[model samples]
Target: MKSEFQSHEPDEPFLSRVQRVLTDLSPAERRLGEFLLDFPGELGSYDAQELARLCDVSKATVSRFIRRIGFESYDKAKKAVRDERATGSRAFFAHAEPEANAAALALDMREEKDNLDRTFGKLNAGELDDLARAVLSSRKVWIAGQRISFSFAHYLFWQLTKIVPEVVVFPQGGETLGEHVARIQKGDLVIAIMLRRRVAGTKRLLDAILEAGAELALISDESMARHADARWHFHCHTHSDGPQFNHAAVLALCHQIVVRATLQSGREGRERLRAVDAVNEKLLQVEW
Candidate 1:
């Protein structure tokens, strides 16, 4: 006879399956379920024996728990959890352990360093120059982003304005992006910075950019590396030891791009900087 568990949806997510069986679990199973609820990705991080040790249950109990959740084997369930973790969900970092100590701080630093290493290790200088060239030569350059990416896009826009005169950043607050999209021309360039938890309209925005005959540069996390619509894709590593992503690498890349473009701009960049300085001195009464 088919058990009640056999009626699970074919494509149910790993967490959904666990949540479904959570209420019906035995005491030992409930403990394991609650542990997973804290950090579902931990399922992929350990084996049955190790998980049993962490959750204070027997190996056999671990076996039964996974089976009850609709996975054929521990290996299959682990792979599923690992796949889901690529979403960069906050659940992956949720834990009861205190992070105010030195060890956690050390781990955060190590992860940041690793992210920097991985991000720059694959970076090609020639590719950066190509992007910088596009920024310099385009009739107009648009910097686009939403959610956590908005700050990065704004920073890039402000910095690039020092080197290029026709730089624009978009979609501030309640305004629709249609006004900006309508203005894109053939000689324009669009640089989009979209990190994890990107909004649903992301594709539509990219599509509009391309359809308007503008060149596209995409700066996003590694999960978006496979996105082929953009002319250039700069995939930054944002993995972190804590709940939030470390976007230091993304900031560094933006700085690099602006600096390179400014250096390449020669006398033109210098004049633009002088103009901006003149305005700052005249209006703001600031010394720099």
Candidate 2:
């Protein structure tokens, strides 16, 4: 049986599905669905009565639309849209410093917590497990990131190395980027980390990896939906910080990926860790 999620393609004709599912809805619910389909971007600013007026329906009809779409009430529907907007806005402002006022700091903290909660709630266990398995099975894994994302790429490289010796972190910048990108081959997995204000270098690297026939996975903000052309993509919320730089949430996400990969890799993962331990001990003994 096809899951409801699987049955609904993102690019499907919107009106067809709306008409099919909302056929039994009262005139008001149909109006609300039509309004959403027609002006989705405007939903963030809509109140119950405002939405109803725009849809040529009563506020009560708008409320029914909420339940029809699986939400309990108009407020719940509105909150979902607001949360999505907040997540996108936060990503754009991530890296900015908190304001000096105590109230501002408190607000920032609240937003961050909400962002994290939303992010966690959206995680798909099945998708995560599949990603882990793919990484473990790949003959080689190349992690690429430029600028703010470089730290996340490096972190994944370090953790993955403990379990998968063939992992490589692309050099920050220089001819090495070109050389490493050229080396990507079939059966390799290229994990790219990119976010708001995407780096040109990262985009170029992703293109190269794609041209080389390597499987690609992307870690980025939800606002970057268009930029990510990977076979698999994960969005991690990093809002609530200042606009200059922020990678706390991204780092946490990378950690989860690595830890899950380790667990899924089974006995081979254990032996790989033991080998890494030996190498680390040897390096310590040889320190200058």
Candidate 3:
């Protein structure tokens, strides 16, 4: 009720405010607090009455919980949590693990299948072909992937090197991007695979690549909006049944890009493969 509302510290986030007094709550209030902890953004969408119903608490209990959490009013609490979630906090991904069971495994598979469907459902063959042609024509191909994105970038780099002759990635052992961005040339193609929890400087790096007159391919997740500066933007679906992101679609997309680039390469692709094979045979004398 409006009477429950009181002045609260404006700076504390709703999630933290709820957490601070969690230990002191009564059994019923504790239950409500625990529920909200899992879905911090829910406060922004659900009113006191709805929250009370969802938490199975009485209306009076909801009011008690709000004031206990230091919210001046429901509206103030809503704005606080909404703004925090909009900043892309990692707290949203935090959840207790589901038990390892057949049901969980099945859910994972279904989610992965959905990821693939959503990723490829709108792909354009003509657009893919055009992008592949750019890869084949570019003077050099540089890839930038940070955190978990680095693994996918490495995979794409390995595949592209089979036919593209030269492919480069970020330097090993924690080097900075400025050194690499300096190398991008007008005819170069930069494939930047930036996924969620991305580094702060990613957009600036992309901007620099564009300013250098280079072709930019940004393969990303829903967290990043499509930008016109990139020559092509491939948005991969990474949602999952578990806390971690499912990256099956990302691997599939990398494979597709390589396959299309190979087709675009034609004779050059075959010649390059043959040359790589010759070197491997001489050095290792056996294929793994």
Candidate 4:
């Protein structure tokens, strides 16, 4: 007789399969499940014995968990994870235990340095120049980011506005995001900073921007690299050492883009800075 576990949908992701079996899982199985959910790509990196060791379970338990999730064997489950990753799954797995005290401080610095190195190592100069030129020549530029990503949007907007004409960072106090997105017209450029597990409606907003005839540029982390819909997409490294996601690479990219845009704007940028400075001086906005 054929097994019922074989009835699972072939296209379902490993994480989703684990989630489906969550209620039926034992405490040890659930622990393994949670880890796998967070780090599915790691599944491809370890065998049944290694996975069981990492999860603090017996090899038999790992085999059972694999079967429970509809895989006939542990190896088969591992291969599924590998296949999913090749197809662009959101799995940037850093299998590290949480550090504490002095060790945590060192880990933080090391991870941030790694993030910066990896992000810029893969940076494309041609894409950067094209994006900068698009911003410089755009009739209007709109910037938007949700959750913690809003910081990047605000910083880019703050710097770019000083040198570029008609630059806007949207969803300011008393404004709806939809209202701003709706105003995206032809010849406009929209830069959206969407990081891991992007805010709801982000994809829809990108689609809406495109439908409205605006060019969309996505500035996101690797998790969104394969999924984001945009005319131009830039990925920033966001590996973190602590419990929270880091933003160092994203900020660095923002800084680079701002510098590039300023350079592309040339004399217009200098004049804009001078004009803003004169206004600041006249209005006593800065103390001498």
Candidate 5:
């Protein structure tokens, strides 16, 4: 009988190729792929030792598996996986026609609502209040995110600036991340947003912030929660519409945080609004 686990043909579908390669893999390689397929979110965040421990394999086995998958090292394999996920996510969303994808989007929306409900049920009021107070009192606030997460960070930065004196959104991929992090004082707060597929640069920034002794407010999926050293952490549950792409639930969480912050700032926020209106009124009189 012909082997069912043949090398993938050039024209083969991605999922089919994945399945074929998985079937052809040695037992150890198969275990590793199974681990990745079963918990892509978890595997995305795990180190080699952690992955090996979870998969009940040795570190050498993990290394061998990585090499078998055509990556020279574990880090390279992880990076490949991340890139594949990002590309797959973008492709899925790009191909989706609003009318044709409506049912799928609706399903996603419903799932997001259920996640929000569960999160609210489990949220600690006192912790939220403390986080709000920290935001209100911090001398400076730094918001950082990459890719899809950049939108969430930008939204929070905008809202926080309305009520707070100093707020900055860290730009995407600069050579000066370390220098920027160096400027954070003890009273500063860093709000970092990352999701299932956390960006490497974002993680590096988070680490730098921790070393600088800045307080952290982390908003991420549950799988990435361990990576952040947050004084307060909010886990946004997201379900994958395909093999990749998970952002809707995170955007909802961002909205929730901004709304909560606005409510907590009340009078201060109103006063700032008045100030902004006055500035806008004067600025509107001038034409470009």
Candidate 6:
């Protein structure tokens, strides 16, 4: 049928490909495409017959839509969408309409649950162990995150500094980020939290960290998957149930990282914790 989807470059985003074919599709096909376009995540959950019923289109139109999108069959189209979706691509989040009242909370819970499942499912055990080892052995661990992500970075930094010596968080008060980058030694590790609406200059900052001979680690949402330089890349899912984005998955992932690092620290970690407790007691940091 010489559909517009056929002209897409191999690397182009599937969402963009769908958009390109929007005007070329018949009325029924366009309706189905638009529905899937708005609820791209649903593509993973619905079969052709079910989707046809939901979109008020016939089975033939569903089959035609699959081919129009450059897939050989309905199953293949669904698989492609699911694969792209698993990456936590921004397209799925872009058009996810906000809900109201109790529906919003219900949706939030559902989406957050899915986030944890998908994120933990994809995590590699060996890679996690390697990150823990890096934390325990590095001369200094430099952590950086801006905006909302800074909260996660701060929590991780707070936990890590108590267990490991020489942990630094960048842009402390009057100091600049570049100053911190300059302090990174060859054996140091840099953990960066870069989620959606990525901070300007983040890639450049990571580059600077790498150029300074420090190993780079990334804790980010699927949108940042293309970052090839990270020694360890942990991608989390951040789908929100409402108008705002959800961060529960990111927090859970960070918690796991801290737990692993603590376990890897072994006797040294226990000694450090005891020392911290002694100081806390003397300083009356925690009220009884």
- Specify the highest-TM-score model's number: 1
lDDT of each: 0.87, 0.69, 0.81, 0.81, 0.68, 0.80
- Candidate 2 stretches with Cα past 4 Å from truth are 1-101, 104-109, 201-204, 226-229, 241-246, 282-288
Candidates in order, TM-scores: namely 0.83, 0.60, 0.76, 0.67, 0.62, 0.66
Off by over 4 Å in 5: 1-108, 172-175, 242-246, 285-288
Where does candidate 6 stray beyond 4 Å?
1-101
Which is better, 1 or 5, measured by lDDT? 1
As a TM-score, model 6 comes out at 0.66
lDDT of 4 by residue, 75-107 (tens): 888788877765443463444344432454574
User: Which candidate would rank higher by lDDT, 1 or 4?
Assistant: 1
Residue-level lDDT of model 1, residues 18-76, one tens digit each, is 88889988999999998998778678878899889888999999999989998889999
Candidates sorted by TM-score, descending order?
1, 3, 4, 6, 5, 2
Any runs in candidate 3 off by more than 4 Å, and if so which?
A: 1-65, 73-90, 93-104, 285-287
Q: What's the lDDT for residue 102 in model 4? A: 43
Q: Global CA lDDT of candidate 3, please?
A: 0.81
lDDT of 5 by residue, 1-288 (tens): 873334334443333434556876778778877766545534445689988887888898888766555555678656655655554443323222245346565654666676677666767777777777778788888887777778888888877787788889876566466667879878898888876456667666777788888899888775563553578888776655443455566776677666677788889888987787678778895344
Which pairs of residues clash in candidate 6, taking residues 3 or more apart in a chain or in different chains?
A: none
Worst 10 residues of 1 by lDDT: 95-104
Task: Give the per-residue lDDT of model 3 (tens digit) for 84-187.
Answer: 76555656544333342234466447878888999999677787888899889999999889888999999988899999877898744579888888888899
- How well does candidate 1 match the true structure in TM-score terms? 0.83
Give the root-mean-square deviation of each candidate in angstroms.
3.3, 14.4, 4.5, 5.2, 11.2, 7.5
TM-score, candidate 3, is: 0.76
- Give the higher-lDDT candidate: 3 or 5: 3
Residue 262 lDDT in candidate 4? 91
